[model samples]
Every structure is written in C-alpha cells, then in structure tokens.
Target: MNTEKFLELLVEELELENPLTLASNLKELEEWDSMTAMLLIGVVSNEFGKTLSAEDIKELTTVQSLVDKIGAQQFS
Candidate 1:
C-alpha cells in the first residue's frame, strides 16, 4: 500500500487526535476498542488480502509494527 493510502486508512480507522506516525502508540488512543481492532483487521484483509489472527492483533503495538505486519510485499 502507498504510505498516503495507508495513512488515510489509519486516520479513518483510528480517528486519531493528532497526526500519526510509525511511532504512534495505539494504546494511547482513546478510541482503541475492539471495534477499532476489527476495523484494522478489515482494512488489512480488504486492502492487502491478508487475514490477521488474534495473536497477530495482540502482538501489534505501534503504527510501524502494523506496517511491518502487513509487509512490504503488500505495498507497491
């Protein structure tokens, strides 16, 4: 995914208060709920055609980690 597209999706999914970065900690977000988690899963699966497991969700901590999990291959 292009970085801009990814960031656009992130903004939509996360409803972030401030600008996001790879270093942004998800735990700090006020809207980080199970619904948000599901949205993220949907975004990855829909955009990249990869399903993320529960364990995969638990392992994610930051924006960079999500980009890493999706992998460079998923991006153009």
Candidate 2:
C-alpha cells in the first residue's frame, strides 16, 4: 500500500480527526495508548502480514517506524 492509504487506514481505525505524517510521534497522539498499541499489532499482522513483537512495538516512536516494522517494502 501507499503512504496515503496507510495514513488513511490509521486515521480511520484510530478515529483520529487530525492528520498524521510519517514523522508524527505516536506517543503524542491522543488516540495512542496501550490499547491502541495492541490494536496496532493486530492491524499490522492482519493487514500487512507482519508480526511485531512487544519489544519491536515499544521501539516504534513514529509513524514511519511502525511502517518500517511493517516492512517498508510493503509500502510504495
């Protein structure tokens, strides 16, 4: 998927009204919390077929980082 679609999915899933960029800090988002983190793990696995460990997820600080963990090659 492309970056636009990825961002759209995140916004839709998280019910975010603000826009998110690749550099957006995940921890800074109001919608980002422990529950959202868990949701992200499932989203990545189910949508991208990429498995993210708790440690890996913890290391994700930015949207780009999560995209990287999901496999950058998976995006255009």
Candidate 3:
C-alpha cells in the first residue's frame, strides 16, 4: 500500500483520466456521487481491510484525507 499504489487504485476506482494528486478534491470529481462513495467504501474495506462509515465519507473532502484515514502506516 505504498502511496503510488494507493493512488493508482484510487484513479482506477474513480475512473479518472487525470492522475490524482494529494490536493485532489473528492467532491470536485465529475465521477463522484453516491455510487462513487459506495465504491470507495468497498475499496477501503476489501483492499485495505478498513471500514469507512457514512459519517467518515461525509467528512472526507480531499484525497489526502483518505490517505490519512487509511493511515500513513499503509504507505510505510
């Protein structure tokens, strides 16, 4: 779960043409919606063995936050 791998997985999940940076805003993505949120929930749960609550999703505004949520340990 290095940062590069996580970013790749995220880009795939979001189906984004542009690469994602730490500053990328989740809400600003055209692909973002309830469906995307649900997809992310599964991604974190299944891939990282981490669960994301609805409240957690609501609080996340940027890609960096997701990295933080899943924890920097995954990268290290």
Candidate 4:
C-alpha cells in the first residue's frame, strides 16, 4: 500500500483527530496505548499478510519503523 493510505489506516485505527504527518511520533500520540498498539499489530498483519508478535509492536517507535518492517516482509 501507498504511504498515504497506510497513514490513513493508522490514523483511523489510533483514532487520531489530526492527520499523521511525517513528524508525528507514535509514542507521543494520545491514542498510543496498549490497545491501540495491539490493534496496529493486527492491522499490519492483516494488511501485509504477515504475522507479528506483541513484542514486535512494542519495539516499534515510529510509523516509519512499522513501514520499514512491512516493506521488509514484502521481500521475505
């Protein structure tokens, strides 16, 4: 998926009022709680058809990090 679409999914899943621009930090977002993190993990898995553990989600600090992980999965 394209970056914009990915960001849109993130924003929706996290229930953010503002759009996620490049500078947005995942940890700083108000909705970045455990539940949202789990939701993101599920969303990533569903969208990319890859399985990720909760540990994997905990390790991600930025949206770019998640994107890079998904991109790597495309090659694997």
Candidate 3 local lDDT, residue 29: 88
| Candidate 2 similarity to native, TM-score | 0.91
lDDT of each: 0.82, 0.87, 0.89, 0.77
Per-residue lDDT, model 1, residue 72, is: 69
Model 1 agreement with the true structure over 1-76: per-residue lDDT tens digits: 6776787788876676667777888767788888888888998898888899988999999988888998966666
Q: Residue by residue across 33-60, what tens digits does model 3's lDDT show?
A: 9998999999999888999999999999
Cα-based RMSD of candidate 1: 1.5
Tell me the spans in candidate 3 whose CA falls farther than 4 Å from its real position: none
The lDDT leader among the candidates is 3
Estimate candidate 2's alpha-carbon lDDT, on a 0 to 1 scale. Answer: 0.87
Residue-level lDDT of model 4, residues 7-51, one tens digit each, is 898788778888886567788888778888788878887888877
The regions of model 4 sitting more than 4 angstroms off are 72-76
The TM-score of candidate 1 is: 0.85
Better of 2 and 4 by TM-score: 2
lDDT of 3 at 75: 80
Candidate 4: lDDT over CA atoms?
A: 0.77
